[model samples]
Target: MSDQKASTRRIVVGVDGSGPSKAALQWAARQAELAGGVVEAVTAWEYPSFYGWGPAGFDFGDNAGAVLTQAIDEALGPDRRGEVRQVVVCGNPAAALLDASRGAELLVVGSRGHGGFTEALLGSVVQHVVQHAECPVVVIRGPAEATRG
Candidate 1:
């Protein structure tokens, strides 16, 4: 409804089934709960293009959706009860997050996701969104054990 949409703040978060991402999701959910907003969990993916040829039999979008669901279940527990909104986009991660963050109150992402980096900070997607997001951005830095899911 228009009333719900107008009253609810929209907090967008990037999820990739990784530790940092899960941490981001948890933070985003808590922020949304405190602010009476909805967390828009976004997951983006792209088909592998090898030499201009794509895979013959693969549903990348479906797989991405499944992964998103699992990540949500893992991060937020099983009974969300519609506390979060799930969004799956088929494109570049930064682009998807930027597009989803339009008119959003806040954009949240992990310091790094699914990357082999415990020493360095700021993954490419986080950097891009932080530099280019229209809304405010929050980068959650988890513990070293956050490398695992």
Candidate 2:
């Protein structure tokens, strides 16, 4: 049996079920493989407000966890699934992603997202995470088709 200590360097990746996020997952997987580390695939979600609703009405208590799990499965597939752990948090996407990145060795995210124009500026989750994460951040844009399978 090998005696090498398993690396503790964690990689946090933000995924929103978009093409660019998928590309980021792929890139993060390669990095995890190289570093002998695991990837934390995170997805932050918030429910649309209902008029004058109470906390119970607006609560997304367990839904976020399910969403994050589904996203990780869709992004990583069976082959790379074992290398990733899914994380879900409530609140703003950028804030959640950045908070999750606190102790990470590297935080990876896509350059764009489902949020249309908001993502055009620094409002992009990737941009915000890169700017605020305590660790190194990597933004992955979808590769040219020539590089894709």
Candidate 3:
């Protein structure tokens, strides 16, 4: 009998439809495959200001959750879908991701996101999560070749 025991780890990855986030998801999936771990793909969203007030106000929380779920599903297709658990949280992206990172073996995110130049230092979510999360964090950048493409 082989001495190697099944090693299971919990990996948390944040996704928001950006190229870098997509890269992070792909990297996280490969890591999960290697370690025999489960991947938690989390997406955080909040109500849009336009819908937060007035007579036409709509509760965007559920919609946001649904969008997040879709994004996670797209990231992990049929073959690897079994290893992923999708979570949609209502709050600031950075705070939600950081909160979710507790006790996780690895927390992965993109170097940049949909936030644009306002988040130049490091994408806000990645920066905050890296500063506060208890687990080791991985920030994936677009491939060097892809940058030129």
Taking every candidate in turn, the Cα RMSD to the unseen true structure, in Å, is: 3.3, 6.3, 6.3
Against the true structure, candidate 1 reaches a TM-score of 0.85
Report the error of model 3 at residue 103, Å.
0.4
Q: What is the C-alpha lDDT profile of model 3 across 1-149, one tens digit per residue?
A: 11211244778889776567767888898998888788878887876676546456455666666765666656666566447777778889888887777667899997753344544467566777888888899988855443222
TM-scores of the models, in the order given: 0.85, 0.72, 0.75
Q: Judged by lDDT against the true structure, how good is candidate 1?
A: 0.86
Query: Who is ahead in lDDT, 1 or 2?
Result: 1
Q: Which stretches in model 2 have alpha-carbon errors above 4 Å?
A: 1-7, 51-63, 113-123, 143-149
Best by TM-score, which number?
1
Query: Against the true structure, whose lDDT is highest?
Result: 1
Q: Candidates' lDDT values, in order?
A: 0.86, 0.72, 0.72
TM-score of 2: 0.72
Clashing pairs in 3: none
Runs off by more than 4 Å, candidate 1: 1-7, 51-56, 113-120
